[model samples]
Target: MNDISAQAATLQWNDQGLVPAIAQDWQTGEVLMLAWMNREALELTVREGRAIYWSRSRGALWRKGEESGNVQHLKELRIDCDADTVLMKVEQVGDIACHTGRRSCFYQRLENGEWQVTDPVLKDPQTLYGKS
Candidate 1:
């Protein structure tokens, strides 16, 4: 097997043939998002040097910044000890990783009781996605 395929084979995928992948800022060490990846997605990401995930909702491959111009350039990829999770350090282009136009998908923080919005939206979602 090739290097990319060989790497994918080592991962412990769930029954759905998916593994949880976390994207983090390469320089800042800030976690940007969490997504799922199938074997093909993992191989494509390694070969292309970018972040690509399997979209459960869309039922297809979702390339980061494919529509929003916020591509994540991969810097490094690491697997957990259990080989079940993937951590990708990447240079996030356009400074946005969340579809909500925030820098990260983890925008909520629990305060005394309720969840609060912590990060401000860097760009308007409507503009990013061209929504009406």
Candidate 2:
């Protein structure tokens, strides 16, 4: 609001008022992962200088490392002109951000109707989640 229209009015958002946010390493530019965010998430990310996400499943707000301690230290945020997507540069601590024990969530590839894990897990989930 507040006449931000001049700065952001063209970005595309989904029907549910959410946008896809991609997280990347600030220095390396390697895509780390992607998450969802609403206006609240975007605001929090900018105001707090930390990664925040909208948990579709949990139906609530979630701050990175709130429970897992695998925090994402935000470095930069890039909003596409369309105002519907965001690119976050962050410093990820710990070995895993995905509950599956992988460093990133995009470790699986669907091939021939079979799910194949494509990346090696950087740490054991149990070590992070305590045998959950």
| Best TM-score among the predictions, by candidate number | 1
The global C-alpha lDDT for each of the candidates, from Candidate 1 onward, is 0.93, 0.79
Extract clashing residue pairs from model 1.
Answer: none
Query: Candidate 1's residue-wise lDDT over 1-132, tens digit each?
Result: 125787788889999999999999989999999999999999889889999999999999999999998999889999999999999999998889999999999999999999999999989999998775
Candidate 2 residue runs with Cα over 4 Å from true position:
1-10, 109-115
TM-score of each: 0.96, 0.80
Residue 11's lDDT within candidate 1 is 84
Query: What's the lDDT of the predicted structure labeled candidate 1?
Result: 0.93
- Report, for all candidates in order, the number of backbone clashes: 0, 4
Worst 10 residues of 2 by lDDT: 1-10
